[model samples]
Target: MTTHALVLKTFPAGSPRGSWPAEEFAARLREHGRGAEVVMDLVADSFLVVEAAPPPAPQDTSGHEASRLGAVA
Candidate 1:
């Protein structure tokens, strides 16, 4: 199955004071796995949810570099 990154944002329950970093949210998602869910406490009564997906592959910079080298050659 194709993996995708997801993010959810929610408001605080009854107070206005606190926030969660994206990294923190992502960590929770990783721990939970596919069906995991989390409610983040955002600034002044706000929250967020985060999901994880297979990390993207490294970019292929070698191809571009090779092309440039060929041109120089």
Candidate 2:
């Protein structure tokens, strides 16, 4: 997990893309303190701001359950 893309501002052609929600675009970038879930406008009027990375530490499986409970060594 680790996504970052700042550019939440820039509209002109066909304007109508400012439904801020994701914590107000992460508070317009407050040193990236919060915000998770936002991916609107990209390229034309740039408007992407997402920062969610902190949930990937749970894969031990206890050594596959000790080899299916066949532990020995």
Candidate 3:
């Protein structure tokens, strides 16, 4: 499971078998540049359309590199 998944929409899981409206909706979101996906919620008896969390910012390593260089000198 992802650490953070925002539920954008919820669809009842009563669609005909082999038909996935939730997935189709998620695919449209993805096409529009959204990181969206569908996940089943058995307890809720529904499909959730979720957007994935953005990745964390890269750590700054300039200070660490400078310290290492100073130690070597």
Please tell me which predicted candidate would have the highest TM-score against the true structure.
3
Write out the backbone clash pairs for model 3: none
Ranking by lDDT: 3, 1, 2
Best by lDDT: 3
In terms of lDDT, the poorest run of 10 residues in model 3 is 64-73
List TM-scores for all candidates, in order.
0.36, 0.28, 0.66
Query: How well does model 3 score by local distance difference test?
Result: 0.85
lDDT of 3 by residue, 1-73 (tens): 4377789999999999899999999999999999999999999999999987776756655555334345322
Can you tell me which runs of candidate 3 are displaced by over 4 Å? 54-73
Model 2 scores worst on lDDT over the 10 consecutive residues at: 7-16
The alpha-carbon deviation from the true structure for residue 56 of candidate 3, after best TM-score superposition, in angstroms, is 9.5
For model 1, residues 1-73, the per-residue Cα lDDT tens digits are 6646565645345543454454465566567664445555555455555456568855656555334345322
Q: Which sections of candidate 1 miss by over 4 Å?
A: 1-5, 15-34, 64-73
> 1 or 2: which has the higher TM-score?
1
